[model samples]
Structures are given as structure tokens and as C-alpha cells.
Target: MTDNSAERRREKQPRTGAEQPWEPEDLVISEGKDPTPERLEEARRRLADEGPSAIERSAP
Candidate 1:
């Protein structure tokens, strides 16, 4: 069998930081509820103003 342990280890490693810049889509406004346009816009604005902290601030 091919040894894939290294790949598995890499996958299990914690991310050093965000792979890409935060986007409005990254926000989780509610559990089952889909975010509205206004909420998305708010997330966009928050991302611009607060950076990644916006995600924490907007989390349910």
C-alpha cells in the first residue's frame, strides 16, 4: 500500500492563518437561517472595517 501518512499529517495540521482574505461568505449569521442581502452587506462592511475579527463579532 502507498504510504499517505505524510499527506494525512499535513491535512491534520492546524492552519497557520487564513488561506485567503476574509469574505462576506465566511460569516455565519445564524444556525439554520440564510443571511439576507443586508446581512451580507453588513459582513462585507465589517470585514473592511474590522478585518478577521469581524467573523468573531458576527458569529451566532
Candidate 2:
């Protein structure tokens, strides 16, 4: 039979550390974060108005 004790031991070992969660301070619109609804609307408006110039009328 194949030996499996090492694998079990490895699984039993305690974790060296836990990963810290990312927490950006500016997770709001007032702080000038990107990807807001305002940014999307502006992009659509630009596409309709400008008609595809590889650029847009507005972006965040």
C-alpha cells in the first residue's frame, strides 16, 4: 500500500499566517474612485456622441 502518513501530517500542521484582507481607504465616489455608475454613463454618452475614436467623452 502507498504510504500516506506524511500527507496527513502536513495537513495537520498549523498555518503559519492568515492572509490580511485588502482595505482601500478611498472605496467611495467622493474620494475619486473609478468604476462608478457616473463613470459608466459618461462612457456610453461618449461612445454615442463621439462615435468611436478609440477614446471617450468622459472617463474616471
User: lDDT winner among the candidates?
Assistant: 1
* Candidate achieving the largest TM-score: 1
**Model 2: runs farther than 4 Å from truth?**
1-33, 54-60
Compute the lDDT of residue 22 as modeled in candidate 1: 67
List the global CA lDDT of all models: 0.66, 0.44
lDDT string, candidate 2, 1-60, tens digits? 999999999899764321222122222232355756766565456445554331311112
Model 2 CA lDDT for position 35: 52
Kindly provide the TM-score of model 2 when superposed on the true structure, using C-alpha atoms.
0.33
Model 2 scores worst on lDDT over the 10 consecutive residues at: 18-27
Q: For model 1, how big is the CA root-mean-square deviation?
A: 5.8
For candidate 1, write residues 5-46 as lDDT tens digits: 999999998763444476676674422346788778877787
